[model samples]
Target: MDEENQQAGPSAAAAGPAGRPAKSELVDNQNFEGQFKFGRLVVILSALAFTLFVSFLDQTSVSTALPAIATDLNAFETISWIGTSFLIANTSFQLINGRLSDIFGRRTCLIICMVLLAVGDLMCGFAKFVVPVTVLAGIAVFLVIPQSPTSQGRMRDKVKMIDYPGMFLSLAGVIFLLIPISGGGTTYDWSSPLVISFLVIGAILIIAFIVVQARFARHPTMPFRLFERNSAKILFAHNFISGVVYYTDLYYLPLYYQVILDKSPLTSGVLILPLILGFSLASAAGGFAIARLGRCLPVIRTGYVLWTAGAGGRIAFGPGTSIATIAGCLVVEGVGLGLSMQPVMIALLSNTRKEDRAVVTGLRNFLRTVGGAVGLGIAAAIINNVLLQHLPAGLPRAAASQLSVLLDTLPVEQRGEVVAVYMRGLHCVFDGRAAGDGA
Candidate 1:
């Protein structure tokens, strides 16, 4: 129907004797290094793994420090912005980053992303004011620059270039939608004039961005056409299904610890280790297992099933639940996440050429990350609504608001009781489960 649409097919050149990359994807079916240079491969993988660790650590570490940041900046309303800003920056440009890598080269983009991420982290660490936070966040978003690589039988290729226009439109679209949603209740009233105006503005921005991409943006970041890649489709499937729970973990786990268990910010950070550590170890393992097994279908299915189970456990950990019980659930869920997460990625990569990998992988990761954020937001709202309905009259009125909000308003003494309410509320939120079930 459109010119971009007509040109949207996978690279016709993918059918190398050694590999079958989709159209426009230049996977030369040739392994220049021959027979896996174990030493060099290990070094390369280690760098990638280190990057993953730093990226993930930055992502999670902030949760632990949020309270301090909030207190220091007096940014009670902008609390959500801290996280939302980064997500918007990181996810919005993911497709663009990918296209850029495919067109220019992955190395340059990745290095740039890493440096930008480092700068962002440094800025976040030192951020004293809201403007600094926003500015730094905008700059730090350069971290998610890797493109998704397509896997092939017996070989793989990475993206050689990057797409700028596609990425900009997509980034704009994500930011436009999230600006209002992220700040809805806290910064502005959901139904208020300004919030509603922002909502309208975001919609228009996204609509405009999409129209431009579909018509213009050659070498688009998302290449809406590239969804034709089977791996791309499956990658999304993995994120969507896994995302429901992956997001829930990041969304509710912290609140559960701080709000229910009444743990200090530092302590809350320690508590999430089982989940984060478990996932980190398992993801690496999953990659190895997938590489050995050379197929992803089984791993994907298994991970999905386990993830659902983990979600069940998380949904069940309520106010009265045993600390040990919650911890146990985290370990189990972490293992499941680890086992499934990397394997699916490997499986997806297994089917793609190296050139497309960065963008595709970035897109997949972007969706999953956003999914987690959205899930967290929904869980927060649900928990808040439930708490409001169930909070005993004796509790402070301010204590009855959303967890993040309430934490900011009340002093430490009153927070314990509020935390108990959150735990119990989450219990009920989890499909009518009681927090006292563990007792």
Candidate 2:
């Protein structure tokens, strides 16, 4: 452990009433006045939501533009890297940013992240490269999110507060784990020594990271006590599933349009509009529902039900599915995501003490990012592996690898065969989520 580990745990004086928090902590509605006025809070959430939308839009837009990008760069095999790399960088520093936000304040973190995002976009525009752009975008999102009011503090030694060892271990663990999962069969064989080494090392580091959190960490990046309640466990699982479904859909739907339907990148993006609108509307509705009901579970349940239904519906799609049908399916999912997403955060706050809000929020977001990254990896692996195994007998490996980009150029029967294989992979992605939902 580093010298920083000595300063990891929160002081006992600040812990207050050991073990789980009391019901008094749950009296959020009664003592809510000191936070923000309902109207002002609404406005703040709206601003923060818009900020999130813009940042996320920047991320999703890359997927829509991917076919064109792969063609232009002649890097179709490495296209998955564009998204995975972003997710890796984004997820790696999540807890660090969460702690930093608690210390420096959300506004300061947002400004820094947004500025970095702008700089990253500018770099992409000039250089026409995606890796650095994704990295910058990842860094930009680290602080733009709204933390609970309790996270703001009067602490002066914020820099010293970071758990450097935990950060490194978690980052290494996630990267090592994700690289092989995402790259196996596509970049390297599953049985390759490189893959086995990464998997083994990643698992060990992850266990070490958990050990640090459980015992060694002074102020653990993710406190074990956060999962003490059944509600917290459920919410974390819910958030993780939502992350998987959300990212998988976001990344793959564009492919469905571009690859199966043979639409242009810009056209695919335009088509994704309905899903976004549904998401925005549903999100707003969730906020209103929670505000009126003074509880988040009902809305969350409704969202999950809708989300499950939407994922199930998407499995019905194929090469001949109508645009209207696909759009409708996306709308269903959008509504579900909107209704369920923010309520989880609200539920976490309702369940935890004010002091732990920042960490809880960080953990929630961290899981979601991890879910998204893992989902993308799984989706990529399925798509690549399936294509490798099932692409038409006559097509060369190189052509089949770039089949998504070159689908339209092939003869009609060849394109059909390729689309059939691609759709199988796409359907598998959705089906897995549907199964997860059912479980």
Candidate 3:
């Protein structure tokens, strides 16, 4: 009886013919030695992490260089496109890449993504316009990431596993949701029919997509069973909120250094290094903790505590805040980010059955991307609203409109007031993020 039960246990988690595992058995079953050589695992994960780092660096590193890029290219009017284009492409391609990874094998999809990302970055460095190049890079990154070890095999009939209907529905739904969130209050009015229509339509399509996944698809892109587990639902929410906190600090801290502290762009980048250092250390430590302990929850909770402390601390920042203070806060934020990021991903993968791993990976990324987009949009709205309501009436439209680049150039008498306006806007953005962290 005991032998029969033991045999029955692993069989429940075993992969079906199409390469997906049943939801009943989600625990790790493969022996470490049979699954991966330590050396090979190190090499593959290192490469995959580097690929993700480059993708993130492409996003975060550009802010410090933006002023120079705007001046050099004479494209200040279109500057927002550099980031927005990337976000749209990155968010949209996640599901498609997840499906492709399932069909073609994780290695194949990753290689294609890396090659495309490399080409796009190289082109951008050569003074090419960034929108298209960055869009392609974003698409590559969304595609090139790793899948679970169990998801590595090639299927017999890849065509059957590709769920075209679900893919289209998901893509359309996400793009619709993202378009309004990205463009509202920037390119169009928040209340405009263009925005409202897209929001409603996007919500409906997403609902429809979920229904179809539950009822119809021969091979549902997102297996409904994955979220049936309560823990998975909570994890997805955590990922979304983390995205908000991560990008808020990343985008704004450099501005604080440049605008409030009177540091040059190069200097600002250097100053942010402590935070990056903390992130690297904690990320490595967190990964080790997961491997050794075989659990992620403890590390994840500790990360939240640190992240909240660091993010909330920044709310007190003003024009006179010290670089030391800012640097310390950044370090805290970085450590929190590093600790939380990898463990959550590891946790998500661990909870999912083998066949669902790639899809869950894509879903995790999609939520993060959406969370980032929403956070940035809210920050932009707050900044713009504050600037409009508070800026001195006498300031030139050009200077007021392009506040970041023009603040230093304004007359000495007005420069301080302009700086104050910017400082207020930054405070709102930071405070909002802190509140999110606490929640």
TM-score of each: 0.79, 0.86, 0.87
Model 3 stretches with alpha carbons more than 4 Å out: 1-32, 35-42, 149-156, 290-295, 396-402
The C-alpha local distance difference test score for the whole of candidate 2 amounts to 0.75
Q: Write the per-residue lDDT of candidate 1 for residues 1-439, one digit (tens) a residue.
A: 5665345434434454444454445442323567668898899778877776776667776656665677778875566666667656665665565555554455666788788777776766776775455445444444543444323332222332233445555666677676666666545567888768866876776677677667875445554654768776867776755654565556456766666766777777778888887777777777777778877767656655655566577666666778788777777678778888777777666566455566567667767766655655555556656666766676644322235545656767666667766666676555422121111
Rank by lDDT, highest first. 3, 2, 1
- List, residue by residue over 221-272, the lDDT tens digit for candidate 3: 7888889889899999988888776766666677777777777878878887
Residue 177 in model 3: lDDT:
90
Candidate 1 backbone clash number? 49
Stretch of 10 with least lDDT, candidate 3: 22-31
CA lDDT, every model vs. true structure: 0.61, 0.75, 0.76
Query: Residue 13 CA error for candidate 3 (Å)?
Result: 9.1
Local distance difference test, candidate 1: 0.61
Against the true structure, candidate 1 reaches a TM-score of 0.79
- The window of 10 residues in a row where model 1 has the poorest summed lDDT is 430-439
The lDDT leader among the candidates is: 3
lDDT of 2 by residue, 1-439 (tens): 6555344333322333543222212111113567888889989778887888777778788888877777787767677677767777777777666666655666787878888878877776666666667777776665566655223223434555667788888888988987787677667888999999999999999999999989887657787888899988988988887788788877888888888887888899989887888888998899998889988889988987887787789889887888898888889888888888878888887787665787788888888888887777777778877887998788645422356676667888887787888888888887998887656
lDDT of 3 at 206: 91
